[model samples]
Target: MVDNNWLAPVWTLFQQQPLAQGIGLAAMLVGISAFRQRDDGRFRLRLCLYQGAIAFHFLLMGASTAALSAGLSCVRTVASGHTRSPWVMAFFLLLVWGLGIPGINSPVQWLPIIGTTIGTWGLFRAKGIVLRLSMLAGGLCWTSHNILIGSIGGSLIELSFLFVNCHTMYRMWRQPLPNPS
Candidate 1:
């Protein structure tokens, strides 16, 4: 409720510094690489938890600068050509934009909740690896949201899950790129 201006650009020492920009670019590269490698994993994990992941990323739009940054970073990354590489992950991004972006200035933060509930069935019915990862990603999504919403344990837990998720994704990337559908 307080006016915490997270978006207000502060003129700190490193404002517009080349190092910062380069760091962002490098991180984007790494993030992009990480994402590319983990397409199936991210897709699998998120697919496993698609409903909740969609809800978590969607409902939390504009809730915090961190949320916005992450959300927009997702958009920009896709726009910059990562999500485009793997078509399935694009569906995940679509989920983010569809249920989440409109919440930027609206009161309907619960849309994803309903959508995810409906969507979860598909994942639940999915057999084998995809289904399993979806379940894990869903739990991760829920936990990430809880952490973002002020759960102290959530952050720590999310970080650990993220570490594993990232590791798996990176490994997937290191392997040969799958045949694009």
Candidate 2:
């Protein structure tokens, strides 16, 4: 467990940046919008918008790790829509690990790194139920990470995402597959 003291300064910093937090909230809303899109292409496009907003929010709040990961996520999300090849998926996973290495200085940092890794792999390779399930795993990691970073909006976003995404997944499962011609 991380020391509690680490959060005090972070909390103070967050309190000072309401605008950044607001942007994060907006990002979360945008992300929820993405979940409503049943089409793969539409989903990826909305995710790109969410990632961009989140990147900016993290940048303003001085959370370089999450910010960079979000930026990379934007790229990864877009690329995944164009290609679902195993090679491309491997490259994305490697990229997450490569970038994570330099940024990881302590155990706490690992939360986002792990989350991003899971998210990158899932977002890039998985489809249908597997994709959402993978993202749920990633969202859990991010929940811990956002809390550690004192990101109020980020925390709410992940928690809400998990709930909403799960509900969406359930709905998808309930729907019958279309009959083949």
Candidate 3:
């Protein structure tokens, strides 16, 4: 936990970054809309936009790791539907981790790294319950990271996403499975 004495300064710094806050709010809005998408294809498509907003938000806030993770998420979400090839997924995973190495100043940085890895795998490779469950796990990690970084909007987005994603997954579960060929 951060010392109480330091928090006031940090809060003040956060307050000064109006553009960052605005971008964060925009990211949150886009993310909420993305979560509302019932179809996986549409969800991933919308996520590309959300990730772009979030990446810029983090960049403006000078959170390099988080920004990189969000940027890679855009790439992952955009490429996920194109191929189910393990080779491609593996390449991106390696690239994300490689990019993250230069930015690791503290243990907290690992949160987004691990979280984004799970998200990339789930978004690119998994389907149905597996994808939803992995996303839930990733969301929890991101929520913690966002809180630690004092990203009010990012934290809110993850929390809201957790609830909405879970509800959507439950709806998916309750529906009858489609007839197989």
Candidate 4:
């Protein structure tokens, strides 16, 4: 097991800056997706497992976004019925969060420190905006043709969505609210 030095790397992750965080978060999603994504069903089972790893890594980033008003899982929580077999992706995200035990809003996204800050607001509204924004950013990132960097930046959109879903679920159950007029 690691000691104090373990925390050292936590701070060291690309999460210390806005661009890094954005690029890092996106890359993480692509990495996870690449780890599992398959154009064909030649390896459905394996790809499924790889997808989980991808989600898990993002989950780590989400947990790190503490009180930053951003948690990708919260978006996932909001968009449950829209996707197919999302629980699988969601579970994988949880795995990484458990492993990393990271800090909040630490240079994880690109332009935004905690993209989920803005994303959370949009996702919480429960409109289609979250997915649309995610897709749009991802598309723009792809069109930029930066290859590796773009892939990461783009993929972050989905990664954040996955995190927001689970995060919100926890909040809904954990935090109580007062009656409204």
Please name the candidate that would achieve the greatest TM-score relative to the true structure: 3
Q: State the C-alpha lDDT per candidate.
A: 0.40, 0.82, 0.86, 0.37
Model 1 misplacement above 4 A: 1-85, 105-148, 163-181
> Candidate 2, which ten residues in sequence have the lowest lDDT sum?
171-180
Estimate TM-scores for all models.
0.27, 0.87, 0.88, 0.26
Quote the lDDT for 104 in model 1: 52
lDDT of 3 by residue, 58-171 (tens): 899888999999999898888987887888889889988999977799988999999999998898789877887888898888899988987867887899899988888887
Q: What overall lDDT, based on C-alpha atoms, would model 4 receive against the true structure? A: 0.37
Candidate 1 residues 14-133, lDDT tens each? 243434333333333343333233444354333223222322332333243234324433443333233333344445546556655665543333332332332243233443334335
Global lDDT of model 1: 0.40
Off by over 4 Å in 2: 1-14, 177-181
Q: State the lDDT of candidate 4 residue by residue for 1-181, as single tens digits.
A: 6579755544554445445455445445443442232221222233233334433433444432221212333334334334434454444345324433344233333322233223323323333334334423433432232223323433454454345433434453466334348
- lDDT score, residue 94, model 3? 95
Arranged by TM-score, best first: 3, 2, 1, 4
Q: Indicate the residue-level lDDT of 2 in model 3.
A: 61
Deviation from native of the Cα of residue 5 in model 3, angstroms = 17
Ranking by lDDT: 3, 2, 1, 4
Alpha-carbon runs more than 4 Å astray in model 4: 1-53, 58-106, 109-113, 129-131, 134-181
Residue 94, model 3: Cα distance from true site in angstroms: 0.4
Comparing candidate 1 with candidate 3, which one achieves the higher TM-score? 3
Question: Which TM-score value belongs to model 1?
Answer: 0.27
After superposition on all C-alphas, the RMSD of every candidate to the true structure, in Å, is 14.8, 5.1, 4.5, 16.6
